[model samples]
Target chain A: MKIAVCVKQVPDTWAQKRLDPDDKTLDRESVDGVINELDEYAIEEALQLGEATSGEVVVITMGPDKASETVRKALAMGADSAIHVCDAALHGSDALATSLVLAKVIGDRGFDLAIFGSESTDARMSVIPAMVAERLGQAQLTFAGKVDVEGSTVKIRRIAEHGYDEVTASLPAVISVVEKINEPRYPSFKGIMAAKKKPVERLTLAEVGVPADQVGLAAVASAVESFESAPPRAAGTVVTDEGDGGVKIAEYLSSQKFI
Target chain B: MAEILVLADHSGGEVKKVTLELLTLARSLGEPSAVVVGAGAGSTVDALAEYGARRVYVAEDAELDRHPVAPAAEVLVQLVGPHSPAAVLIASTADGKEIAARLAVRIDSGLITDAVQVDADLTATQSIFGGSVIVKSRVTRGTPVITVRPNSTAPEAAAGPCEREDLSISLSDGASRAVITNRVEEKHDARPELAEAAVVVSGGRGVGGADGFKVIEALADALGGAVGASRAATDAGWYPHQYQVGQTGKTVSPQLYVAAGISGAIQHRAGMQTSKNIVVINKDPEAPIFEVADFGVVGDLFSVVPQLTEEVVKRK
Candidate 1:
């Protein structure tokens, strides 16, 4: 079985984020980049599946050449090879455009399975994998908490509002892993050295058959207007812990209608 | 006039509350059309009509059942070919958001996720940088695809003419990825999800350990509100990630949000600062939660929560 895992390099959410002075969008410059949190689960799942079936895991990501860092990290984690879809036209592409680029690459490259994190932390859209599956006409599962493989078929456990439901489908599909799926493994020193020798192929929009006219911010459908800051919170009044602490507490509760 | 497509989330053939909320927001962009993909009865369609859905798209294929996020996207894309909606609206849950992303890509359109507001002009507003900033975005390019945050809009009860149309899409091999052979959903004694709920009651570090959360839960139950926990509590492993309320957790804008024993970190406020009315109860008079509170009580939670629950129960 061959699996393709989609990953995105986003600003380490732990780091502080600032807005661009010219545009309302986030300031990506100087932000420390890291593999999206959820994508780590996707890569781990792919590696595990590859080990079980004695197959291979292929890492796919779209970004500037710097995105190779995410690919290198995936390779260090146990993927067999990588594919980087890089192009200037891909900048500012929305989820739909991103998915289109991915679908083009996946369709041309071929894969038995495609996986993605539930959503990129920065964009938090969680739509690209589903879009790829739709474009590829593959069956897809979202927010998989658990997964099991049997022969060529896969079964997934999804968490719903009221209860968990089990759904089974054939391979050559896509699944967006939820946070609860599995804990991702940190890259080992040995694995990092080995990753240097692994194969990582780079593809462009033309190479993947994606027409230049079909990609980029110009192809997007939505637009943003002016933004306003959320209203400032009102000041708060603190009740002192007087000698009768319990009584004061009770009185406060009663005043607030808690009693 | 552009048509906005909405995916109706349902259970046991009944439309979920978030579905109505999605439709309510969908109406902001253009005509609202609901797509219900699954088995079971037609009760969901009726509910969609009640929520002012002008068209109900139904696709009941056994193969489509549990196809996960991938095939679901295919179904919607197939539906979009003919209808060509200006935007597609879905709930910003784990699954809903994923499917919307895929649809946006398949159609080569723009996608805005976790949107708090959808204006008449189709601009999408999102709370970014942990709710410290509100960023308004427009897909200057394809169909504007958006996943709306739950509870962003009060579901208006306005019934519209209902027309049901069954959609058909050919599922391609390898399109269905990651199949679920089994599922085990953790049971919650509380009401609906905090993000999708109209009312929420949350606890923070002041509640102490996992056991203290019971008091918060009890108060939440009395008010039929979902339970939320601050990042401090979740980080302490006292609550599940689903219950976490902060920049890293789910974003909720409900009618009423009650904070108990919470200090209201900046990250925690980022998740729920948009609530209509906020009530904070903390033992520490200096806790930050009181800063944005509409009502505040300075007292020990251990003694305050039980009495609050009793009062709420009595009123109920």
Candidate 2:
């Protein structure tokens, strides 16, 4: 019942993120980095599942050397170990390339299940889980609000358009969870001390069998052609309610043909 | 003319507004051809034709509906090899993006999601980091697979005779990896879908509790619009999470968005900033939502919302 959870290091949501002027890609260095908010939920879910089944949870992340800080945070939260896929040539890889490397790593590691956040706050593509599942030739159950495992069968309450649906798949599958699934736990001081000694394995692209020709900015399948800053919002008209505010709103709605 | 393939989204034998919006955007890129999957393609042809679909590829395979999204991606993969369209457009719904992702992998194409705009040259304008940054991107390797955000464009009616092409697709074992055991349709409400609604009334933490949503619902009903809630309210269990409007929630670009008792956080603003017109009502005058609002009213929502609903009802 070993599980692998994918985590990403992203610019903190509170900090203002900017795009690089030359390449139109995210300027990661300009802002402070933190683990993506949603991935915390995935880490927590994996830890809980591990405790429930007496299994091991391994945290995997792909980024520069600094991304190990993110993996340490997950280990402090109770994962068994960590895997860091760090390489200079992996920069600016598209979802396809990223999923390729992840699939290869997870496939080699031999996990009973793989977990991912529904999307990354940075890219917000929400595609990697499906792509990795397709590449690994495994079942994918994404956007799960609730997950349950029983006797090699995994069941999930999938978030659908209006409501939810019950979806089921076999073991050795991939799943991505939504934020509503569970509350993430904070790392205690004892956990933080213990995490420092936990095993962290670092791997390069070549170690993972990813060809040098398939990744990086030059080999990226997608390219940013251009960018434009969003237009500044105009000053809005504010009205203090002096008992006639409702009347003012009605007039405004009518002026806009809304009512 | 180069053809752009669009995956038509339909439910209950009717085409969704997002599909029409995709068709409208597709026409600007190239000649729009719709790939209709499931049992209702025949019934949806008229609407597709009205929205400028020159050709509709129909795959009436029952396995598509029985299984999850893999079968549809397989169908699209088969079509991509033969048609070699300039680009593929899909609605950026949960299921739609999944299909697009699988199709991109199967065909080894670059994929873009949540595109707010696509230029005639096929460059996609993406609003990322909770709408804090905008990047224009394009697929450099192969035919681009793009998922357009709902309500990004207004659907325009352009009459055309839609030619139908029947597609016979065989499902692979991978397509049946995940099976849907049961489905429960959401309760039908008269209000329009939040993503497609012209007007949306949303509440936030200032609403106090679940009971406070009554005033918001009344105002929404009076306006014949959809009801939305901020993540704060939804997380507090005041409303269903599905109705949440924020970075982690649904992105809505309605014509008019009313925020009552909402002290708009950046996450919430990211979902609704593209709205054509925004109105904010809050007790706090320093609310961030007022920054992007077209009009603002500083007052308590309980008093302001009920009076606004009454005024709106009286006007009609």
Query: Best-fitting candidate, measured by TM-score?
Result: 2
Q: Candidate 1 lDDT, tens digit per residue, B210-263?
A: 999999898788777899998788778898766877665677888778898889
What proportion of the true contacts does each candidate reproduce? 0.61, 0.69
**Candidate 1 structure lDDT:** 0.77
Docking class of 2: medium
Query: Taking the tens digit of each residue's C-alpha lDDT, what string does model 1 give over A109-134?
Result: 77888888877777665567667777
Tens digit per residue, CA lDDT, model 2, B226-270? 999999999999998888888778888888999998888888987
Off by over 4 Å in 2: none
TM-score of chain A of each: 0.89, 0.97
Q: Can you write out model 2's per-residue Cα lDDT over A107-216, one digit (the tens) per residue?
A: 99999889999988777788999999889988888898999998799999888766888989898889999987999999999999999999999999999999978987
* Pairs of colliding residues, candidate 2: none
